[model samples]
Target: MHLFRSMATLVSITGASLILVGCGQKSGQQKETITTSTDSELTTVDPSKTTAVGTFNVLNNVDEGLVRLGKDSRVEPGIATSSTVSKDGKTYTFHLRKNAKWSNGDPVTAHDFVYSWRRTLNPKTASQYGYLFSGIKNADKIQNKKAPVSSLGIKANGDYQLTVTLEQRIPYFKLLMGFPVFFPQDSKTVQKYGSQYGTSAKTQVYNGPFTLTQWTGTNLNWTLKKNPTYWDKKHVKLDNVKFNVTKDPSTGLNLFNENKLDMAQLSATQAKQMKNNKDLISRKQSSNYYIALNQKNKVFKNLKIRQAMSMIINRPMLANKVIGGGAINNDSFVSKDLAVSPKDGSDFTQDVTAPTSMGYHPAEAKQLFKQGLQEVGRKSLHFTLLNSDTYDQKQLSEYLQSALEKLPGLHVTLNNIPGRVILSRQADHQFQATVANWFADFSDPITFLNILTSTNPSNISQWKNAEYDRLIDASNNDDGGNAEARWNDMVKAQNLALKDQAIIPLYQSGEKWLVKKSVKGVIYNTAGANYNFKDASVK
Candidate 1:
């Protein structure tokens, strides 16, 4: 499950987007005279928002969920010490920590989850992740304006026990609970701050391992200081965790080389160049990169054209030469190695597989293009491939543009924009096609695959199949269905998604990162995404 393109990460943009630095400075102006050991070009810091790097760093040292993802990527008790679910996996009863209190010295309770979920789905929050909870009973109805917030399937059994009822059986529901959107909010704080809640460090209180020190509302750089109130404070060892936004891979690498940045993404060229370095480490993250066609658009309506697009490119070469060698050839929308593969703990030994049609053959691509042109009664066509303007994405998009033009009737245009603008276009459906990668918030295929499908609320690609939708509905409705049989149905749905050619499946994802080996307790879960730093301590 890819989040932030791999593990469970979410960075949906809203009104004003700023890269949150894990510091207490609102302007991200740090104590310049302090003995700062790392270096980078982190310009702004805001509390209202955070970058992928900032979110993860803050997750462990600052934000505390009812439960947290352990360093092993498995679920462990957070504020809640233990939880019990009904036999059918429909209702979850959580036993919250009696002494677990917020930074404000307020006790955290089950109602926090209820309030957070409702606030996220409140229509006004406009949380794109609100759809992530659609599977919850009444969630869809409330989000769709078909029901009331009170009807949401959660009840506060007294104050400590949160009894949650899902719409159907979700074997992986517990893992989903560990995602960021599901994290609890302070009711009093949210109401008092209103729109300003979650917008700044001063406005928010810490319940996790670290507390936000100096981040302003604008995101750029910030730090996480040890939280004295953390129940398990003894297990957290880092005196402070700093976050810097390194959007440009080359610049990030430069800073890393200069010893200004401890960790950063390497350019494909930089990664290859540094492959032999003592500090470089590559991980096959649970994420995939691919294009999504807005089926509602006429250009994407023809399957042949879609197939033609898929067949023209050489994915393997792109992975090795353009996107960085560590990127797996992701032809399947879901990471084949996602979730803890029962067959093996490692992704290489996982049971996940790509779609049958996920392949590249120049001859096949040309043939599909010809067929598509004939269907549309056109000899040639033009379209643009939209992508985020980041360095790696630019290289990847440009490479695809050159490759796709191999087909005689195709004229591909590359449209790259800032991250903020790209997110806007995706939400507003302003482009014909987009190169987007989805990450999972939990260790389940549905978390990634289902959202890309045509019937999904987040399905910007407008294609829909009755059979595909039916199968998903069936899986969710299966109360006593055999587990193996359920898997068969899921495969059927994924296969149908492939068969429609509505969206092209690229290679499954692999994570790649560079870390200072001294940082221990950063657990890596092969199932869902995200690095758990709850117990991680710097040597």
Candidate 2:
């Protein structure tokens, strides 16, 4: 569910220096590449690997999905030109445009979807993301090896009509389709190349607006040439998108100053320095940064300790001091500004849960810790908090360690590991409490809440409330996704989650990035995946 949009150049998202050099001969001079961070180390772009900045940054242009999210956060056609839903909402049929073709000029067909889903769910493939498709028929059973892959709920009626069936009603189904998990794959290419398929540009084929060119499996740079077979070939304007990974902020900034990088991520210091500047592009997203307590631990199971931990942290200090102004202290697990109003603009959620406690309050936090300790009959508590080893994660972890110790009886230990390791440990439920962040896979509340269900593979925290799960189920089924009723169900769900205090909400993200003035048509979207490089252009 960790879907990527923009590629970061350095470890830090905020502005860094650029170090990765561009690839291919200089045919026509264009604007420089955009890095999500200001870092200076260069990393290679590989399409098969899941990377935030790399895939969507430049190499993503060559990849074709069934549907693409447009600048308006609306579902737009990609491989499939049009689709229709059943009156019961259980069946969705799509019509693939006749002209859509792979980079090899072979027609991309509905069977591609059928083949791809089976491939991703093939237990031998061991794709961790197979759970995202559980809403489809027999997906869970297949992933669990209880059923064969053929039972998956996708059918190719012809060269054009791709039909899908859900286990039940799902509201964000379209948004799920917009995700890369559901994108089609050419059966022949994948079978022929075996393990080497999609590892390099030459090994794979394209059907989107761009055709990838000149990327070896380990190359730090890649180029995407426009695909003439795109359905809307006329509107697919950019000739190609070139990407290079730069891992240092200072060097990235140097490139920015020299007009080489078109856009870059800013560091806390950099954002603080440039926030008010006209060139800074800041966006507040519907993402919540929080700490997930593994309830399996006897110490963490104590509500008193949970409440104490929640109360003591200074959220505003982190927002104001470390994160700067683009972030706001969050109370509800779901970030504000996401589906706050109905399509017709009416309030949906009633503020039933106590407002999220954000900002620094050492005194009250110490008192709560004392109260919790006394109630639990414990003289002191010890626990390790895990986080990803990224700079932001380390920064946040260190700050939390200092803040939590101020509480007399609470001693916090910090462990910073690779993001992949962090994810693995989390899935294994191997920590006391961990800093967890979620970027929405789609534009629905269910996208955030449903994944935390007791049975979900991604439910790493093992925090489950039957009532909360029920509400989420209602939102996905009866309420019909992103609806006012669904939002109401979400408000109810978050309130219940707060009442249980299984997790603490910290701050919401403000989608902040510094884009040099010359970049255009980056295909930015507020919801779902944020950017598409296919249409990106440099003037």
lDDT string for model 2 (451-539, tens) is 66777655667887788888876775667644667777877887777767757777665545566665676665544445576565555
Provide C-alpha RMSD values for all models, in order: 5.1, 4.5
Clashes of each: 56, 38
lDDT of 1 at 504: 71
lDDT (tens digit, per residue) of candidate 1 on 390-507: 5566777788889889999788899976554555576667888887655555666666666654545456677788888777766666622355555656667777777677677555
Off by over 4 Å in 1: 1-57, 340-357, 479-481, 526-529
- C-alpha lDDT of residue 10 in model 2: 20
Candidate 2: residue 96 Cα off by (Å):
1.1
Local lDDT at 192 for model 2:
82
Candidate 2 CA-lDDT value: 0.63
